[model samples]
Target chain A: MAKAKLDKEKLLWMYRMMLLIRRFEERTAQMYGMQKIGGFCHLYIGQEAVGVGTVAAMKKGDYLISAYRDHGHILAMGTDPKPVMAELFGKATGVSKGKGGSMHLFDNEKGYMGGHGIVGGQIPLATGMAFAIRYKKSNQVVVCSFGEGAVHQGAFHESLNLAKLWNLPVVYLIENNRYGMGTPLERASAVWDLSQKACSYDMARATVDGMDVLQVNEAMKEAIERARQENQPTLIEARTYRFRGHSMSDPVHSHYRTKEEVEEQKERDPISSFQAYLLDKKILTKKMADTIEDEIKKEVMDAVKFAEESPLPSLESRFSDVYA
Target chain B: MAEITFREALNQAMAEEMQRDENVYLMGEEVGYYNGAYKVSQGLMEKFGASRVIDTPIAELGFAGVGIGSAMVGLRPIIEMMTFNFSILALDQIINNAAKLRYMSGGQFKIPIVFRGPGGSAHMLAAQHSQCLDPWFCNVPGLIVMTPSTPYDGKGMLKTAIRDDNPVIFIESESMYGFKGEVPEEEYLIPIGVGDIKRGGSDITLVAWNKMVHVAMEAAAILEKEDIEAEVIDPRTLKPLDEQMIVTSVEKTNRCVVIEEGWPYAGVGAEIAARISALAFDSLDAPILRVSSEDLPMPYAHNLEKEVLPSVDKVVRAAKKVLYI
Candidate 1:
């Protein structure tokens, strides 16, 4: 409760968390390229602000749920890197005991609902989580995250309608990174402004600059506050971009997007922008930032080593976790 | 104990579970004010109110997924899909999300939810809304598929499905909703993953479920008249099938015939038939016969409708085939 403001320490913590997420992703992408990690890997590089900002607004009783680009949310919510990395390595020590790699990370202890694989699959699930919070008459809210792509799924619309009708304490966030795999946002959706789509359900909705941590945090704070106080749901469309391809399997050339466009968006990088804000505000010295980077780099390296040493789940494991 | 109709018994099971636990709730298309399309959720909206006895949109997959999510947190939600045919829209949520969550999350999440509704052919409703989906879902792991024929079984099995820590598919019958039968008034629960024997004999084993259970009983009666004698078995729960009951019956009779309203190829009957063939291989006096719906969409006409679904006549014919009579 003390010093919750974006002061030097808090900003530093944010940077450290985002840095950890970024390092984990960068090396994870490299690992994927090296064939160390298997299955679909959706990097959370450009969209770190969305996870970091929104999770900051969440409390102990609050819950979080998201699509496959979920490593960042889990890490930010305080899940150990070893288990998550082990999950990536398909090892038994993983969060999902190696059965759910990349896309199905779950940490119930940390209030992280899941890293659901199917698009828009978690929307109704998250709505139900909020329903539970309200049903129990608790003050907790749920942050249900989905990509702009999920707007096409029927669950998305259905959940929104129910949440609005019931006045459940839920925050429906759309990480509009402007692309759905190979399809750009323009081609994928007729309505370019995703937040406005919520108006049809008569739900409170807005859009924010997803690359700016401050803007996203401010938006999330308002949404979370309204959800808890008024028992109303909020929909936020954070307009952002992905620094990498959709997945490791996707080639840069197969899509309609150009390298120039990607490089141009890199100029508005969230991490770099936050760093600039810190330097201007004199929140942290350049040397201190460098030390934090070194520490995070070591953590990522240690995680990679532990994952390498971790044992793979046995063939018998295919039957073990079905019950418990 | 007071006797209740199948419809009243189903209502009692849900009402009792909801009264006993704060987490139990029922939601469906017409389960609220309209008092259940088949009256299974009768007076529930009054007892539990509109919030818990929720009447949702016609979107089956959407509401079904919501029920899965609600169950994931702490509530036990029974999502009613007016009939099993309507469950097709929500199949992905039921099969993919609900059925796979517990295993997919590696024991982190439990979908203690129920997708309950009437199943099998429902008399002249035509192709799209009358065919059964038990076979499609029984194939999926992490789910307990159930079809209750008797009022007592309906009351007991539904209560069990509500309390289970995994997703359960509870099938009812539009044809048997109003059927009168004795149901225990006391709070009773039948364990899931276990089958039940409705009638017992020794000449042959006739296994069926839902409306087919009646067919099995009818076949048993016909065999009784012919002095052939048959054991009528209903594997109430489909997924964690009661192979023991089927095997034991086949051992006693040395012959078996499985009846299902689903199509002949790859129906729930096929799975039980194969298991019977394996378990009762040495004990069998004749081959295992399957009495199943013809592999086609149900027609709107009454005669075609009767012919399309597995009936008492089919069960009798199938029993003769197994007995070589």
Candidate 2:
């Protein structure tokens, strides 16, 4: 593929965003260990490129919905980290008012639809949002993201068929991290190549290296443009890896895979690789990289302090928001 | 007042709402050119265009979730399940997504959508197609369940449901589609959680809804011949039930009998019976009796199907049992 022609400022912005996610998740894991943050917390350690690249390709007013592993997506969309960290702390000032933990972050103002808990549940909802955009004659599009395991669900097949049949404006993004909890994708899926499954619906398909932010952004630009201009739906598979376990309960290297394999995968970490790319391109110097690191480290720590001091949700709030 | 069939009343409710709000649209199998599986949405495609009256593939979960997704972004969608039985395929979207999005999202999103269709035994649809699912939806916290018996209540209550800012399960009866009743030409909206007393009496209070309300009326007529006046009360909306109306009626008559078309176990009748017993224990002269469908899956044979459902004779017997005569 030809060189991505991104400017110096945009490339540096992507680097900072990826580093911020890495630091935020590291602190989140530490908080989980201290028992300050509870519930099923899934970390996005090695898959930062997919979330950052895809959100970079999107424009204002575009909507996004993702599965349980969604802290990276909302953060990539420029949501304040204080509220997100507070949400993980289950405090009243959180983005979802502490109602939704790590898996259910929602920032409606940014068009970040939700952090849905179910595997394939958000697929049809994204298709419906595209349908609404068409119904209202709006030019906006919707991006629906899910893990590779969600591809086996009925909601995935059903949604792709409707999106193609109606020519709805949507992009179905699959972040294939190679495992669904302890089970590998090869054992779970009938077809190893997930993009081939889109052929059943005759929808457009693309694949990108999830560790390379530029390649993923290039693919997303083309797919999102197709959706916005032609009202077509595309299924883009980003071959990525999650360095952490499925949740905090599971270890990084379990019986599912060996410890050496986890260490080897870390060598291709999205954040480190992107930093190398920026350095090789002469767009970022060692001094600039150190400055970005220090800024992000302070920001992550302040978020931790904000979350630690935040109050738990009031008891009366439990009954509110159940209707309307 | 204009006399119309139950189907026409429902059609008017959709058409008027669609005319009032551009965000309102209808989607389902056979809803567009097919004119709806049961013709409840007849002529909608022609009036509102295909964009508004959408016909979808036979994927209940897909279209149901699509309606909810649209509702999340400020669209009022009336999703028709070919039958309430088919809605079982989409229960996850309804129960988990639509019902929980508001609370889980901390009120950032409100799902103003409706899942409406005919429920309960209709002909010999067998065990699969024939079911009364009001209790299933009523059991959920975020959903509002409505079962209107007459054309007037059908039109008025559906309009109310469409305009309300909450997810609604509006269940209609297949057998009552052609049933005629008086409905005003002017616009009207019935508030949710209010009960209507269809008949007034002093001997016993008969509680029922949807098709069972008619059966309760028939039972009341039979009890009237024996000098035992029975008051028939229909709680139009099941979830936010009008407990005050039923409690007051039971206090006046001092006797109660609840009837329903669903199975006896955990049915809506059971909930109402429990509520009346709890709230009107001091006023009760006798224990409350419930007449419900036999605790079995609907059988295909005509005789067995009739035997499994709640009938006027069964309701009359339950009322007489409560009256101790």
Candidate 3:
């Protein structure tokens, strides 16, 4: 395959999305500390490049589904941050009508299926969506994202086998952040290379530098193209890392990992590296990067305000939406 | 009207629905070239082609989730479970994803999927294969549980379930598939959450569903020989139960007997008995009685299986106890 040239406009947009996710997650952590956001809040701090770059490769009509650590994925899909933040605040005006909190954000109009709470529950759902695309005879594809921990689940294997058996048009992207809520990959999985699991289903597989947006985008574009053109599924493992603790309840450096290890990993921060790359490539200037950061900071703050002022769902709403 | 077996009625329901809407399709194990395990989907693959009548591998959880995923995006899928016993393997998909997706997404997705297959005791299939799981589904708020007693009811209720915008657990019986009943040639639908009076009388109200409705009918017949009349009511849709109908019948009869094929503890009969006590307590002339399967896993021996399940004798005994006869 020839090396596809990256468009300057898309590169700039990816930078903006990555920064926006970073700022949004930082504020979310603050809001969580203020007791504004409750429940299991998993921030996508270090995995911004994976979400931004992979979503950038998807077409307009294509569908995307992911696990609970999903604020970045939905934001990368171009969903308005206001409703997403309001949903985290459990407000009526929020997306999903505030019924789904941090772990269940949904933007149906954007083709962002949901922020599924279960570990690997979204795999079969994504395959099913791909089945629908084929059933409808459309050129659309589906991108399913899950954490590294989900690969050990039976749902993951079952869905992969079905997708390969039917030749469904889906890309099962694994965001391997090295931890399943504190349990390291070495402790949980016998096979270290998650991409090898795809070989069991006789499917295509790839592994990419998830911290680099350009590389992630390149790999995703090729896989998505294969899905749209040949109607074949691909399993791509994006090697990434989560900068924060698993959830709001856990400390940044838990007993499982030392503070020095977390600090060393932070040196290879995805946002700063991508920002430096943009500047060096002349696609984004220092002045432009500063301006984008300021804009995103304000935008994220506005979203926080919107969520703060939003009203709680009415008493009658509890009974509604349960049937239809 | 045409007389047809319960299996044929279900086949007709799937055929008519698939013909009516291009979005509706059937997918399950052995549903294609092999027909259905119970042959309920006989000739569907030949009629609709492989794309519509898909044959899935023996992966219940995977296929069940796939059906839900398809339904989420506007395709109506009828997922056959081979038997309700196998459906236990896909409970997470059915209960968590299918049932709760619409609610959890705040109504962003609608899972218009139907999971239908045989359930309950069939010959001596034993404990693993035979189970009356109506109460398990009935406990969930988002799911719609339906158990049709006759061919006519099965056909009509399944059509309604197909058109419904919610997940419907359409549990059929392995034993009742061969039973024949008169079904209308013209298209008709039995509205959900409505009960049917198989045999009406004044002495006592016999509440039953699925295969137990037949047991209640036989018990009603035995009660008639002793000059004790019983009204047999079948609440085909169990989740959104026809509570009003049962309460009204109990109000008139003032004596009620709840019959079910599941174990006694926390069973569907216990729920009905509780409702009767709450809704028509003052109307009762005697305490309501329940005739349920023995509180144990179904035994394999022919005599033990019969003894474990609800029979005409048990229903009659419960009816007599309720009526002070």
| Per-residue accuracy of model 2 over B235-254 as CA lDDT, tens digit each | 99998999999999999999
Q: What's the DockQ for every one of the candidates?
A: 0.69, 0.89, 0.86
Clash pairs (backbone) in predicted model 3: none
What is the DockQ score, from 0 to 1, of model 1? 0.69
TM-scores of chain B, in order: 0.97, 0.99, 0.99
Task: Quote the positional error of residue A207 for candidate 3 in Å.
Answer: 0.4
Q: Please provide, for model 2 over A6-70, each residue's C-alpha lDDT reduced to its tens digit, 9 standing for 90 to 100.
A: 88887888899999999999999999999989999999889999999999889999999999898
Clashes of 3: 0
lDDT of each: 0.87, 0.93, 0.92
Model 1, TM vs. native: 0.97
Q: What digit string (tens of lDDT, one per residue) describes model 1 on residues A203-321? A: 99878999987788888989999999999999999989888888877765355799889889999899988887787777877998899899999999999999999998888889975
Residue B72's lDDT within candidate 2 is: 91
TM-score of the second chain of model 3 compared to its true counterpart: 0.99
Clashes of 2: 0
Residue B269 lDDT in candidate 1: 82
What TM-score, computed on C-alpha atoms, does each candidate reach?
0.97, 0.99, 0.99
Best by lDDT: 2
